[model samples]
Target: MFSSGDLEQAKTNFPEASSRDLKGKLLLPGFIDPHSHFGMMISAIGQANVAPPPAGTVTNFSDIIVALENYRDAFGIKLSEWIFAWGYDETQLAEGKHITKIELDKAFPNNPVYLQHVSGHMGVANSVALAQGGIDENTRDPIGGRIICFDDGKTPTGLVQEISMYYFAGKAIEEFQGKKAELFPKAQEHYLSFGVTRAQDGMTDLLSMAFFRSLAAEEKLDFDLVTLHGYASLKNDDLEFKTYKNGLKVQGIKLIGDGSRQGKTAYFTQPYLTSVFGCEKDCVGFPHGPQDELNRLIGLAYEKGIQIFVHGNGDAAIDMVIRAHEEESKRLGQPLDADRRPVVVHSQFVREDQLNKYRDYGMLPSFFTNHAFFWGDVHRENLEDERAFFLEPHS
Candidate 1:
């Protein structure tokens, strides 16, 4: 029971003490965060909340239309803009073809519409957003990404995946930048309330890093922060790796190797359950890291003392990361350190053999368990015999 004067004196003497006043229960050896995306978490909190289709109705596309209508009506949304919705599962939709742009236009004739997949990696925007993004029939897909278009006249049917969705959503993010920063303190407040004393600002770069540094220099950092700047950028040109040290160690590089299950492009070895009518070969998800480029990047990251944290949501992609790590270790003539424990975030589809390799290489896995409850059934349907069964298994 230290009084205000005693607390003030202690704070004055110990400037690095996180809490100026001790008002809560102090637990010994408290919480440590292995992984998190604080910026994305803040963005998610800011997005509009639309109710998902009822459990039994998800497999039917018409039911999704009904839910969308109900949601739009409930909010009294205007007809001029698109009806934006999130958490739609296309795997369960009727015919599993997903609600096409034509379908959305029919239901909400006056308004354009966009429905984001539950995975946040893919989405179907109406003709309005397609036009807004200047994505016409001739717009070529970006490297390592895809733009799903229609046949015959070759119109963009609004289905865009991976970074291609960036053409639209990234602009929205840029527009909301100032507001997003306003929400940063509130996100930090939530982290502190949950007893998260230390955190890694995962998947953020450039402007976001600048914002965080400004806050830190002003002595407003809410937690002991470790910012990770290598997300999607395999080169140091984007990461500015020389600027990191002990106070904020940028020791790891994050490589997004594939898409997620909900996005239906996780790059599995086998065909998806929804890929019917001679579509087996074309049904696989996109791969960010091709064989040769991945090897070069792995070697570069290793030589520079930057640990690799690859994101793999399918067996094929996981195999890619494992193979690169194998070559890296073999070339170096030694295994990585256990204490450092370079990680693979959202490692949801590693095979049984990969677990042993992980153990052998002293790699830690930060699984995205959030999907285990939300999309478990869809996973079971699509990857029943595949390697997804052991995701987050107890060993």
Candidate 2:
């Protein structure tokens, strides 16, 4: 605390400024989280109440099944509903492959299961869970994602990628019957305690937006919330996006370009470091924005004044995103507005050239630098030495 004389002298020097005699620590302002998936946070935090795994390497799908059963036993997972879990890494499994539907069925035949990949981009669901959600062999993949079907068979393999995961998983959330009104306030309280004044919620749609608005209306929302409404694809025929777009405090749409390094699905310029073959150039991850679709979506987004928030974890995908943006900008032949900072979210492997391209197009980026801390070793082992140097934070 300052003395009265000191206070007087300070005030005299800055007469127009106000002073705080407050006791608690005060924080400064920033962009806040300009986006996020609060739902994922809630789910992740909520899972702490669940079971624990066995004390060894998860050797295979069988081990995962046993571990989940053990975890469920410890956590009292009710058989009346589904068994939902996250933070499972496939690379560590015995074959370094994901758990299949058959393995899950054998263990928890009576219960439905939904295990999300650590990346939050893909998930494996048991047959019971798929049947509960009405995702079947005949169910075609949505515009943005592919439902991985076992080759030469009509049976669904239970691996749902990109958009399809959201589509069916959302329906599953509905089945849980948890209301947003009851959840958002709890989530907001958690955010405020952490000094978060703003956040950008990924995959936030109009329904979730209404929930946020309701919280604000009721004085429950403590932080300023913004979101990138993630879409399956921006095809003109999709009415859901248009409707949801009109209804939210959304900044734009998100397209997940490929899977994360943890999933070994990220597109790379070279082969995996662990792969026996020092071969397979252009080893890009599965392309979510194939060919002209990305271009078309950018044009549509620009025309509608909605920003594009693409999820590009691989350098190849980043380059594609930059190329698409550059093409769109050249075609428009004008500079974009400062606020309309079309962003590349998760620029985990952006090269210097790509960064230049981003600057050239007046684009903004949101890097998930956290990945470096989380999966740096795997990235180093799998990607070429030159490209691995450029991932995360994009510095």
The top-ranked prediction according to TM-score is 2
How many residue pairs clash in model 1?
1
Tell me the alpha-carbon RMSD of every candidate.
6.0, 5.7
Q: What C-alpha lDDT does candidate 1 achieve relative to the native structure?
A: 0.67
lDDT of each: 0.67, 0.66
The sequence of per-residue lDDT tens digits that candidate 1 reaches over residues 289-325 is 5876777777677766777777777778878877877
Which candidate leads the pack in lDDT? 1
User: On a 0 to 1 TM-score scale, where does candidate 2 land against the true structure?
Assistant: 0.77
| Poorly placed runs, candidate 2 (over 4 Å) | 1-31, 46-80, 92-96, 132-157, 231-248, 275-283, 336-339, 393-395
List of clashing residue pairs for candidate 1: 59-92
**Which regions in candidate 1 have their CA more than 4 angstroms from the true location?**
1-31, 51-97, 103-116, 151-153, 192-195, 231-251, 276-278, 330-340, 385-388
How high is each candidate's TM-score? 0.75, 0.77
